[model samples]
Target: MAGPGEFELIREYFSSRFQTGAQAGGVDSGVVLGIGDDCALLTPPRGKMLATSVDTLVADVHFPASADPYRIASRALRVNLSDLAGMNAEPLWFTLALTLPESNAAWLEPFARGLADTARLYGITLIGGDTTKGPLSITVQVTGSCDRALRRDGASAGDHIFVSNQLGAAAAALPIVLEEYEPSEVQQQQADAAFYFPEPQLELARSIGACASAGLDISDGLLADLAHICEASGLGADLKLDTFPIAELAQSMSADAALETALTGGDDYQLCFTVPAKYLDHLQGLQLPITAVGRMREARGIDCFLGGKPWQPRGTGYRHF
Candidate 1:
């Protein structure tokens, strides 16, 4: 099949994808400002600061081509939102760079629909983006503006570490994709749903607000990603591996598989944050209960305790190398 030109491709596939209509009347939504001109226009509320982050989803790296395009769109946008959440910022606008092999309306329609739904859910707008012919990849840049922004360096020694939601859903989905094990109907649905439709915990992050000293969403496995916080905060971590929230279905897998999924696996997208022990009650009040997995110390290194024994990962999680 012949590929459509770039303009036709954008018109058919991406034009209505973000559903920024609520910001409308200017263009798609009833809002007053337009983004179609060479220079896009945006108006933000006063005293708000902008927090920006960019994420790239590469073919065979981020998601499999056979996976639902709608899911791909949702995950791509949600991941960026997750970052904003980690910083306790409110999302305002997003820009997308879509590289596609060819144009197919069937794939683009639901994809755009899913993208729009997520944007609406988070009260974010898609101001502009560029599309080009190439391999399948999506690079999303999300900007969240806030009066106060959270930073990783704010974490101090003696802070308690916490996480929202269970870990390893994305890891658990891998075997199903590889056809190694056939998941039960319910298990398949649970794993696949969480993997495909990741909830970035934007509200949870925003709610945590001042309670979170240092924060980040767990994309590249908990141990590795948290280590980034450790390094940045000038601290070390003592983690309780067993305290990790693993799903029951995921637990049914082999011990090695479960641990591997939990430790070295990536794409969980849950938030890992630190808060002063004095603020523990604050976190609990939000109902975002956290396992007292470990402590942050002035010392340097990552250590883990599994079943009351010492543990060290054989390798870092999800390295491209």
Candidate 2:
């Protein structure tokens, strides 16, 4: 079906989907002002500091236009939230900058609904933004407040590395999107869910706040994201591929494909962090299902080992260049 023009699309598709009030569709849980306001106002609970992050999802670059608009909208916002979660922050407010070739009310409605649902879950309020005619792309900048912000460079040489949940599901979805292979029904569901509705691990971040010294959401896969921590801490990491929390879905793929996808492919969005040995018990006691995939080392190079063998990947993580 052909899409509708812009203004009608926004009004019909977007306007009703997001109601700006605590009582209205639960969007205003902590929001002071919502939707129609010139700007949104929000105050974090006392004593917390704020951290902000901006992420852009471009058409063709981030997702194919054929992708579901609702999923796209949710992902656009959640990915930004993932950044905040990595910092062990509480989501507070957000602003969106959206560009589209044309508007269709049908598309915008579900998109706004998806955004509202995810925002409500994170207690984030939408403030102000600009809508313009252009190529299809979305940019969301989110603000989160925390008692203490986690930094990427806080890892010490002796810290232990941990990752939340599993990896490589998003990368595995690429084959489905590219139609290179037909995924089994279960695999298709896993891949599509990974691509569309990724959880930002906010609960884990809140639970591990002060205990987490250095952390980042793994948008660029394990090898690449861990390298960021390694570079930031001025140290090295020896990642044990066998210890990586590879998902059951990923395991169904060929061993080589799974390894490459887990190591070099991007978009996993799980938290990779360091905890001091002293807090190891607290971390372990939490029983968060995190695995010690690697450890911080005194050396200054990033390395990975799989099956007791060196894992040398030809390419690093996702590089726009």
Candidate 3:
């Protein structure tokens, strides 16, 4: 027997289920046209610029092939949302292109449910996209609006570097996920949680946009992502290794292992940004769990120090090649 057709699949699983909180006859949602259209029509909030980003996640390349569809859907959406947060943009809507080996209701049902739930939580509407038969992959293109976007080239020498929340939790979970390490139940739970549900620092992004000179989400490990800011700003960074905010799961391992995971492991969707030193007090007032890990310097590369001496980590980060 044949499965649901493409249009039937979209109508049942996607179309109306992902509508924004906008009324059908109203202009409040900024979405003039949503799913099922040949093209989606959106009106940007007056005087605000549209910030758009696209991300693609392939099975096994970005997530475990055997990962739950719900978690996979959540991760795909959240990671794209993280990009909008890094730009200090308010998410409005997104388009999803899904390629699957076959149309299975068992998988599509949960995937759509997870996607819809996450979209609602983030206040984003599903605008439009395509579905095809192929290797499993998901591509999300998100559009947000912002008055001013925090950019990579804005960091100045003497600017202080900050990262949101603890790092390396997701990295620490990788060994357990791959079945290479056996961790305690609590440790496993903590690491797995971090890996599965990365919270995009959207509120923090809005609060810091005015004060932060440069920023990016730490999807590619803190050190590697920070290096992007340094390179773009024509500056270097000196990170206080001892000040690295290690996650609880990472702390469960040896000090060296924890530090390595923190420095080189990827999939941590936190924010790494730079703010002028003068805004230190203002930043502190925000009361978010942000950590001042280092400062931008006049030199041209990143220099990490532990115990007042230069420290080199084992790996740089995850690379696509």
The candidate that achieves the highest lDDT relative to the unseen native structure: 3
True-structure RMSD for candidate 3: 2.8
Q: What is the alpha-carbon lDDT for the whole of candidate 1? A: 0.74
TM agreement with the true structure for every prediction: 0.88, 0.88, 0.93
lDDT, model 2 = 0.77
Off by over 4 Å in 1: 1-6, 16-32, 178-180, 255-257, 315-321
What is candidate 1's lDDT per residue for 32-121, written digit by digit as tens?
A: 443444545666555767789999999787778777888888889988998888788887788877888877778777878888888888
Q: Candidate 1, which ten residues in sequence have the lowest lDDT sum?
A: 21-30
Clashing pairs in 1: 21-29, 23-31, 24-29, 24-30, 24-31, 25-29, 25-30, 25-31, 26-31, 49-146
- Backbone Cα, N, C clashes tallied per candidate: 10, 3, 0
Candidate 2 residue spans exceeding 4 A from truth: 1-15, 21-30, 314-321
Candidate 2, which ten residues in sequence have the lowest lDDT sum? 20-29
Candidate 2: tens digits of C-alpha lDDT, residues 83-160: 998888888778878887876667666778888888877787776566777889999999877776678898999899
TM-score of 1: 0.88
lDDT of each: 0.74, 0.77, 0.83
Clashes (candidate 1): 10
